[model samples]
Target: MELKLDTISKHYKDKKAVNQVSTVLKSGVCGLLGANGSGKTTLMRMICGILTPTSGTITPDGQSIYQLGEDYRELLGYLPQDFGYYPDFTAKEFLYYMCAVKGLSLAKTKQKTAELLALVNLEEVANKKIKTFSGGMKQRLGIAQSNINDPSILILDEPTTGLDPKERVRFRNLISDISKDKIVILSTHITSDVEYIADMLVMMKQGEILLTDTPDNAAQSIVGKVWEVEVAAQELRAFEDQYMVANFHHEGERVRLRLIAESQPTENAQPLTPTLEDLYLYHFQEGGTADVSTD
Candidate 1:
């Protein structure tokens, strides 16, 4: 499967939510990384045909998805940041209802509901009411419901937000397994999620794409430009004032700081390789004013 966004743009009166963004995504797992309100959700919504672009077009497998209506939706599965579930319905019933809505035959819905429950590790709770399920379990059920129709493209927005560590790992592996033959777009603020499972990474800032590359490539763009310094606690404020500090922590009387600089700032500071967080910080650390030199 393939998804193409051609010069897509969205405007809200005086503010532009997405600006002439264009990219092609193929069958694999892709990560969308951005800060809150950076337009990642808006982009995903446009691609899913939930929101129309102010200008330009979106196509799935060469078909204009927006104009095609249900034909386009048939090939898509979307789990929004917040999904609703019937409070009184059992997990199995809810999934069954979703399968019906997706146009699956009765026999197919039964088979799919069982398979999805197993895939999401929610089979144990299949007969339990949704009101009794934990936050993580509900999220898993939401994912199961999204895949009822076996869509060729899957879009998950902050899918791991409320998950525990173990649940998060399970969800990550599930996503990776399901992405083998389809396109999966994961949008989240968690950097580690993309670092391990994503085949490609897309970073956005201020309604525009800041970078699109492999995780390693994105980190490499800021390589040799990050630094770590240990200074006396009293001098920490001066260092903060002089640099864009990505993060900092205290060790006894010394303060260890991670700072972004065009070049090494001090002789005592050592150059450090960049991570996804570093890349994220580099983009918005100075109120989006920091000039970044990319490869």
Candidate 2:
């Protein structure tokens, strides 16, 4: 299946939430990397038919999403940025609830609930109340619920936001495993979420689509433009004022800085391999938000 967006735009009274965005997606994991308020959620909302675009076309195959109607919804599995779950419900109850919402019969709901609880490694705690689950376990349940209908297109918004490092890695692996034959769009402000797992990445900044390419290609796009230098701890501030310092680490007495620039900032600035985080910093540092999280 192919999903295509052509010049999609969404406007609030004064703000253009999604500006002239266009792309075609196929079956695979596609990561939407962007900063907060960058319109990633709005674009995904339009794709899920929750919101209408001010201008543009979203089509599955050759038909408009509106034309597809319930047919289109049946193809989707969406987990919004702030996905809601019943705090009183057990893991099993939650999955069964989602199954019923998706219109599954009792027998199918019973079968899918057990299968999904196992798939997300939550069977051991299947009867526990959702309020007691850890962030990772809650997210795992969220994934299980989204899959209740076996959707062809899965949209996850900020899926790994509160997960710890190890849990984040585990979640990414889960997404990677499930995306084998489905079109999965995972939106996140953390570059690490998609850097190694996504098949393709669509970057956004200030409501505009910046670039769409493989993670390697996005990193390679800034080849020879990243530099690292070691300087006194106090001198790091001077470099920050004149160049885009991506990150810094302190050595015994000096600080090692990784920065991005068109030309070498200093004679000692050594070229280093570009990473997805480096590329994110290269485009978003000027936006003045802590830059996209590498952690």
Candidate 3:
């Protein structure tokens, strides 16, 4: 399914959660990346029809979500950043309950429950209470429930937050496998997730989307513009005060500063290729510039 947001805006009292944001998400995996308070959750909620936009509209498959109501919800699946699970309910029971809430017929729900448990590799633990599952297991169970109805559009917010490295890789592969014919919006601040799975990337800051492009294109935006300068530990603070440093690492007695700018800061500085983290930090930081340096 395709999701189109036309000048969608949401407000909480005097603060705007989404400010006239407009974008079209087609079938494939697209990532929404931003720091906390960047309005990603608010935007996802509006798109899922959980929270209505104060202004503008959200359309799924050519129908306005607000006008379509439950019809729109039937085609969507959303996993919020903070999801609640019943402590007393087993994984299987929880999924079955969710399927019921989604209004699926009993036979279909049973079939779907089995399919999802296998998909998430949780068939072995399906009968275990959710309170007994590890963080990663719970996350997998959450994904299973989200896909219970085989939704056409999937919106996942920080889906890999509490997972370990191994679990994260497993989850990434699962998302890639499921994204073939659906519009998947994976929201996270983990740049590596976008690097590995996103066909397109969207960067947001303070309720505004700063950039939307392919991962390669976004990384290319800062090419030849990032510099690595090795400076004395004592001088690091001074260097950071005057430049936009994307990251830094300690090496023995010195620090290697990754700075972003149009021109090199000193003779010792050497140009370095930018990563997604560099591009994201550069665009979202306070007083940061949108200028793309091709050279």
Candidate 4:
């Protein structure tokens, strides 16, 4: 199934939340990378049919999503950035509730409820209230609920936001497993979330689609531009002011810095393999011509 966005745009009074964006998504995971206020959420909302575009159209297999109506929703599943969790609902109850909302039959709901709880590894805690679950548990439940309808398209917005390292790994693995034979749009500014799993990367900046490429291609676009340098702790601030510093680590009394540059930033700067994280930081900064302000 081909999910296509044709010059999709969304405007809010004076702000252009999504600007003339167009892309074709296929089966597999597509990472929607952008910082806060870059309009990732707005674009996703429009794709999900929760919000109409100011201009342009979205279609699945050459038919308008709006025209498809309930038929379109039947093939789509979404887990918003701010997923509404019912604190009082147990894991099983929550899944059942979502099935009902999706208009599933009672028999199907009972079947899916058991299947999803097991899929998300929540079968043991199936009776536990969501209020008592950890952030990761809730996110697992969130994913499970979205999958209850066995959708062909799954859109997850910042699904790993609050998860710890281990849980984040689990979630990424889960998403990887779930992407088979389905189009999974994973929206996140966190590069780690998509670095290894995403089949394609759709980057956004200042409410516009910046670049769309495979993760390797995206990182390679900045080849020979990534650098690592070791300097005194006091010199760290100087590097920050001079280069697009991606990250830094305290190595003893000295500091190890990872940065991006057009050429050799310094005589002692060692060239390093570029990564998605570096690319993400570079784009959000002045280097990629994006203004990362929330406005």
Q: Give lDDT per model, in order.
A: 0.87, 0.91, 0.86, 0.88
Higher-lDDT candidate of 1 and 4: 4
Clashing pairs in 3: none
| Best model per TM-score | 2
lDDT of 1: 0.87
TM-score of each candidate?
Answer: 0.93, 0.96, 0.92, 0.93
Q: List the residue pairs that clash in candidate 4.
A: none
lDDT of 3 by residue, 1-295 (tens): 7788899899989999889999999989999988877899999988887787899988887888868877777788878777899988999999999989888899988999999999999999889999999888888888888887678999999988867788888888999999999999999888888888999998888898888999989899888778999999999989888878877999989999989877888998999988887787677667543322211
**Candidate 1: Cα lDDT at 286:** 57
Prediction 1 TM-score vs. true: 0.93
Root-mean-square deviation of each candidate, in angstroms?
3.6, 1.3, 3.9, 3.3
User: CA lDDT of 5 in candidate 2?
Assistant: 97
Question: Which pairs in model 2 have colliding backbones?
Answer: none
Q: Write the per-residue lDDT of candidate 1 for residues 1-295, one digit (tens) a residue.
A: 7888898999999999999898899999899988788899999999888788999988887889857787887798999988998989999999989988778899998899999999988888889999998777888898898888788999999888767777788778889999999899999877878887999999988788888899999999988879999989999899888888887999999999999888988899999989887887777775654332211
User: Model 4 segments beyond 4 Å from truth?
Assistant: 249-254, 286-295
Q: Using alpha carbons, what is the TM-score of model 3?
A: 0.92
- Model 4 C-alpha lDDT per residue in residues 140-225, reported as the tens digit of each score: 99999889878999999988886788888888899999899899999987887778799999999879998999998998888898
How many backbone overlaps does candidate 1 show? 0
Q: Between candidates 1 and 3, name the one with more favorable TM-score.
A: 1
Which window of 10 residues has the lowest lDDT sum in candidate 1? 286-295
Clashes of each: 0, 0, 0, 0
